[model samples]
Target: MNTSIVGTGVAVPPNVVTNQDLVKIMDTTDEWIRSRTGVRSRRFVDAGTGTSELAAEAALAALADAKLDALSVDAVVCATMTPDRQTPGIAGALAHLVGLSNAVVFDVRQQCAGFLFALDIADMLIATERAATVLVVGAEVHAGYLPWGDAWEIVLGQSTREPSAEERAVATRYRAWSVLFGDGAGAMVLQRGAVHDTAASSGILGSVLHTDGAHANLIEVPGLGSLQRPYADAAQISAGLQHPTMNGSALYRMAVECMPEAVRQVVAKVGLGLADLDLVVAHQANDRILEGVRKRLDVDDAIVPSNIGNWGNTTAATLPILYHELCQTGRVEAGSLVAFTCFGAGAHWGALLYREP
Candidate 1:
């Protein structure tokens, strides 16, 4: 048996923040941001909306695309690093908001590898006969974490007021990262296939995920941790601990080195080679990294598509969102073999393969 992703959908906020927009409030230029991250523009959520709202909307769209009713979903797994609250997770709230009342809901945090993790879990649930239909979602509202400062009025478009020189200095501290992310959600519906199916022609062929926690500190937001006397405090905020710090060189090296290998390893699992792949829906970490993977694998530019120039890095949402957009273009032809890969902050990474019916 196989677990096939039968439907896909994505949702992004209405607001578009261009590289030109970032230059207004930060010590950066359009050329600096684009030449480094390949991002021209990205979506930012309206002031009040959070992760769950975007996830719920994407979930509903996935159900509709699948021609599925919410009641028919047997399980819902949400993957995110950002959530409105801690206790219940976005899965529970998303289930409630999307009417997936009959589904057993939960959440997973695999950083950028999140959607891949969700896909693996859904495959297990379907293969084991535990659930016939599973909805997996990847969403993030990165703006909430971006060092908004007093410039929130400008970033959120609440006011025409310009950020002061002092406000610009504050944002400059994190511009390298803040400019590379956006807010959005993407989801897909996975359904069980017939028991007679063969691995030679099945959905979700296999997934290989890896973690290297020794380097977890390479990317981190320091304020909230169980080891802290208080998970978070004004002191942490005063020290700018709420914003993330990272080792970009190390991450870029890791991605360019690891992803192509993971892709090869995953395809080999199903007795296929890199040449057999028709499309590679990789995580939109950076256009340069994607290019590196493409060049290393020696695949045609058309086979490896990217949306980072438009969406920036929506973290876990990147893969599914890109996949949905590709589907809309009718480029994923029938019987096409697609490969997915992602690497993210916990040093987590993985690659999965699937075949179109």
Candidate 2:
């Protein structure tokens, strides 16, 4: 049996935080951000909302797209680094929210490459006939990880007062990494079917995944993990150790090398070459990383589409959001050879090939 993605959907908060907006809270300019990350604006969730709510919204939209009801889902696989609680994870809440009572649910944490990992899990279940239908989602609520501190009211539009000098200084210190991410969720509905029928066949054909833990330090969220004796402390939070830090140059080089190589390897596995792929849906990490992948693969600029400029990197939600937009706009069509690729924080990266049904 083959795993076919029957529908796709995305949900992003209405709070559009543009580069100009970041200027008010952090030390940054529109040109400075755009020139580096190719992002002009990004979305942010409201103060009270969590990742599970966003994922459930996306899951419901995907179910509507697939013309399936909540009861039809057999499993729910969510990929997220930001869960509502450390104990129960987001999948169960997601399933409950969507009324997927009969579904087996779980979560996976692969950072930016999360959705790909979640998709692989859903595909495996259907391939084994353990489930005929699955719901895969990637979601993140990154506002908590930013150095908001005393500037929350200013950033969240609750107050008109300007941030203090100290607030701006602290935000600036973490802006390098924090400004690159936004909060959102994307989902897909997959089902089991014949591997590949001659006339109208569409589904995941093959995938190649790789992890290089040797360089995990390139992106580190120093505190707030099981590794720490106490998960999080006021001292750690006050010192800004809770915010994620990154070695951008190192990650850029890693992304360019791994993403295209994974694409080539997986395409070769399916007996197809890079030229056979009509579209390459890559994670919206940064424009530089995407450009490097395009250059190495030697493909036309149009073949690799990106929405990072509009949405920033929505972590795991990038692929499904962009893919859903493409499908809605009539870009991806039947028989189109599509390649999905992503490289994320764990230093996890991968590629999967699919044909539009």
Candidate 3:
């Protein structure tokens, strides 16, 4: 049995924080942020909401697109780094929210590579007759942990909160990552069937995944894990250990080096080349990283990037959300060859080459 994406749905907070808005609170300007990262603005979830709420919204949209009832989904897989709690996983919560009473539920935690990983699992389960329909959701609520001080605001965005003078100084030094992230959720419904038989009229052909843990520390949150607990310090509290972090330069180099090879391998396995693909949906980490891979692969500039000018990165949700946008706009059609790639914090990377038919 072949497994295919039946539908896709995404949900972003209504709050749009523009670069100009960020500049007022931080030491940085709109030009500096736009030049470094292709972000012009990002969405911030309102207070009191968590990842499950966003995931449920996206899942419902996906179920609607699939033209299937939520109860029909046999399983639910949630890919996220920021779960409502550290345990129980967001999958169970999302399943309940979607009214899938009998569905098996679980979570995948490979960070940004999570959605691709979840899709691969969904594909295998459908191929093996283990599930008739699977709902995969990637959601994150990063605003809960934003560093509110003016020091961190210099590098991070002040859109989440007003900043003080000291916070502005700190923001200046760490502005790169602060301006490059946004929060959102995306979901997809995968069903066991032929592409043309479904509402979407397309299915997945082939997928490839890879991971290298040796460089895991190259980009990661520095505190609050099993290995180290920096909770005792006031500075650590202000820095938000549980939130996302990265070594920008290192991550850029590693992704640029690994992603092209992964793309090449997957495309070759499918007996196609860059020229044959109609769209390339790489992880929305950074514009430079995407361009770097494009240049390395010598792929055309026509490849669409779903990263909106300023949504930053939504990790595992990036590809699926982008795919949903493409589907919504009718940019992808039957028989179109779409390439998907993701590389992230676990130092993990993977690619999939599939035809939309």
C-alpha lDDT values of all predictions: 0.88, 0.88, 0.79
Name the lDDT of candidate 1.
0.88
| Candidate 1 ranges with C-alpha deviation above 4 Å | 156-158, 194-200
- TM-score per candidate: 0.97, 0.96, 0.90
Residues 59-170 of candidate 2 have per-residue lDDT tens digits of 9999999999999899999999889876779998998899999899999988889999888888899988889999999998888787877687787677788999888988
By TM-score, is 1 or 2 better? 1
Whichever of 1 and 3 has more lDDT, that candidate is 1
Off by over 4 Å in 2: 156-158, 194-201
**What TM-score does structure 1 among the candidates reach?**
0.97
Model 1 weakest 10-residue run by lDDT: 193-202
Tens-place lDDT digits, model 1, residues 263-286? 999999888999999999888988
lDDT of 3 at 258: 80
Higher-ranked by lDDT: 2 or 3? 2
Write model 3 residue lDDT over 1-357, tens digit each, in one string: 357788899999877878887776567887887777777888878767889999999999999999999889998888998888767689888988889887898999888888888988888888788888999888987776565443333234433555677666655555667777778999999987664465442466677788788888776777665665543566665566555566789898988878788888888886777788788888888788888988998877667464657577878778888888888878888778888888988887888776776
